[model samples]
Target chain A: MSDEVVTPLSHEECWQMLREEEFGRLAFRLVDEVHITPVNYAVDHDTLLFRTAAGNKLLSVAMGAEVAFEIDRYDDHHARSVVVRGGARILHEDEEHRADNVPLRPWVGTPKYNVVEITPRVVTGRAFRLTRPWLHLTLDGLGQE
Target chain B: MSDEVVTPLSHEECWQMLREEEFGRLAFRLVDEVHITPVNYAVDHDTLLFRTAAGNKLLSVAMGAEVAFEIDRYDDHHARSVVVRGGARILHEDEEHRADNVPLRPWVGTPKYNVVEITPRVVTGRAFRLTRPWLHLTLDGLGQE
Candidate 1:
């Protein structure tokens, strides 16, 4: 009772949407297990920037890990998603100073001493429209069908 | 200007919250690149159920791929996130029939020939509260802060 069309978004559209969102989920592998963390980040140029204190996320980056970052939005009728896959590296002292100038800040109140950057190698996005079956039924009852 | 306190959620609390959400982002590695897709899914006895047609997600599960599924909710003041690390597998014909009994449905309204199940090996979550520095400034101007 639901019908919708799924469409692939362009590269520019995906990047633009990514820049517009403030939060995303970062996925990585640690200790032979995959882990995902939701983080507040800012985009600078082509790199994604976020702060981290001492935690699994920091540990994974310290080991030079490959990660996936994703952000999405959905409503009853529409949905959009963007995914970025890349390697994460802790910024050097000089780079951190430059990043500090970029106004990158973490939502957590605690001070995050390290700045990590994910240089996305592949970015893809999908957009789709959905028609709820129940909604359709309701409309049919109202003689709108 | 964001200041927030992040609290680690307990296992029970995380699971409870996971069952409450209807949609999540699924992360997996395909062709050596990590990719994530937003999927509408349902929970069945601690397992995540979702549908996919002929796509990378279906192909990945057919290969017995490890995946990470994440769901989250956020507002101006608080955010909660849950991540499930698991292996994804396509249901066998018999299992497929059983899954049809579950309340699992796709949001895209497309005909998904394959039903996939993700058996989570580890689940974790975090909750945080943020006080926007800008909001504080506005409140201060009104003599409320």
Candidate 2:
């Protein structure tokens, strides 16, 4: 680990990057079982919304019903990732509210018969970078301040 | 439905493409929950072998654990995936063999801690292509002779 330097990005910057990302893999848990799937997501109001079928992923979610949803993005040069973890559950039972029904991108057929929402619990993130010999010297000099 | 006329790759072809891929994600049921991680892997003797710590992924695969390991690749032009649904367990003892300890890349950490081997029960796979206005057809044309 010696001779390597890493720059850190702030929470706000990481959150902004995550919000700008359009797709993410959903992580779920049921009776000690873990599963993940990639899907298009709508990110707004400090939460996430996902649409899935009543398949194994959803069926498993119903077993214990407590779940965590994560969203992240990595910058190429910086090699940084912003990950937001949260608790999720089926959307509130309100057929009158059309907010959950709006599909971010319409494909075909009925858009997601099941919709779930996740409210973030903890949002911790990190950034990694390479420090070549020359780069390391420059960074060390700058850190003296 | 008839535009550029690109054809869908067969399921067999999808499997081959998946094997050619060096990176895939492992979704495991956490002993008390579920966890998933993107892993770099190599096909060894026609089975799955990836390294991990004593995390949820391995705890869930103590001896004879049913799990799902999947490989997927897609772009705006096409999307294809190969999913392995089956049993998984540790391939070696707690100590890692020196030969398998090579790193994923110079920067990425080691690929050998304890190799997890997944023996699939049903390896279901499919491929899809989106060329605009055409229906999202499953790769039913596994037109293999």
Candidate 3:
């Protein structure tokens, strides 16, 4: 792995970075709108799971239909992402994540909450570093020195 | 302030509940795609202020773009929300919340972070007691009531 400033992180590197993250953002679209929510999640193979209070964040993503989850990480000029394109159906009430062990901070002074589990079938990612807008490229070298 | 089975909390009550929260989700759109991040924030009057490690979030939303921030509280069957849809811009780097006195467990895990402030032009909310698909809503309701 070289310290080259112009190299892009590989597809596998992108997925690895995303998986290394214990938390991620949940993205969803509805009509002309899209919503993203922050969640404490664990990547179980190819699925994404997080706990929410059940109303806005969880139900809003329901979107009266399907939704998407996007988890990404970036440092200054380098960004790598992995997206899970799949329809999300709210999980059965708080059995998974055990509800009691979720490391979530209460944003509404509430003591308890529910959980949502998403199984993603289509997982894809992209990685690149920008030396400002005038110079941007994908590190196709796979970070090999 | 009726303790009826479906009593709705007023805006004041909701804001008070939200004030106790120091974390929230910031959602935005870039290239027709939605992205979200969780931040530890402080409520300044009506706006949401937090810090970021700098990336697409700052690029997309802070460059005079629209975004959304949501916070909610939920119990076994009752929930309430407060969402702000407006513009997010970079706040002064020396804001009060930047104090070293604050303790935060940030995923970015670095001190080179920047402060972001989200000023919501539209603040909307609704409360409900949901049992399965049947949603019992209160004031500002937008779903099945």
lDDT string for model 1 (A28-139, tens) is 7664455667877778899998877846444554347678888887766777888898888877778887566554556667754677888988889888886545443222
Those runs of model 1 whose alpha carbons end farther than 4 Å from true positions after fitting are A1-4, A54-58, A61-63, A134-145, B1-4, B55-58, B61-63, B134-145
Best by DockQ: 1
Error of 1 at A122 (Å): 1.6
TM-score of each: 0.81, 0.62, 0.47
lDDT of 3 by residue, A50-100 (tens): 656657554644633545565554444555556665556656654554433
Residue pairs with backbone overlap in model 3 = A8-A139
Q: What's the true lDDT of residue A141 in model 3? A: 16
Q: Say which candidate scores most in TM-score.
A: 1
Tell how far residue B16 is off in model 2, in angstroms: 1.6
* Model 1 TM: 0.81
lDDT, candidate 2, A23-128, per-residue tens: 4556565454445555555655676665555453554355334443434332222344444555666654583144344333422133344556667766655544
- Ten contiguous residues minimizing lDDT sum, candidate 1 chain A: A136-145
lDDT of 2 by residue, B2-115 (tens): 332233456567556545654565665645544445554555545666655545444545447666666655554455556665677776575345215432221134233556
Q: Which candidate is the best by lDDT?
A: 1
Local accuracy by lDDT, each model: 0.71, 0.50, 0.53
Q: What share of the true interface contacts does candidate 1 keep?
A: 0.44
Better of 2 and 3 by DockQ: 2
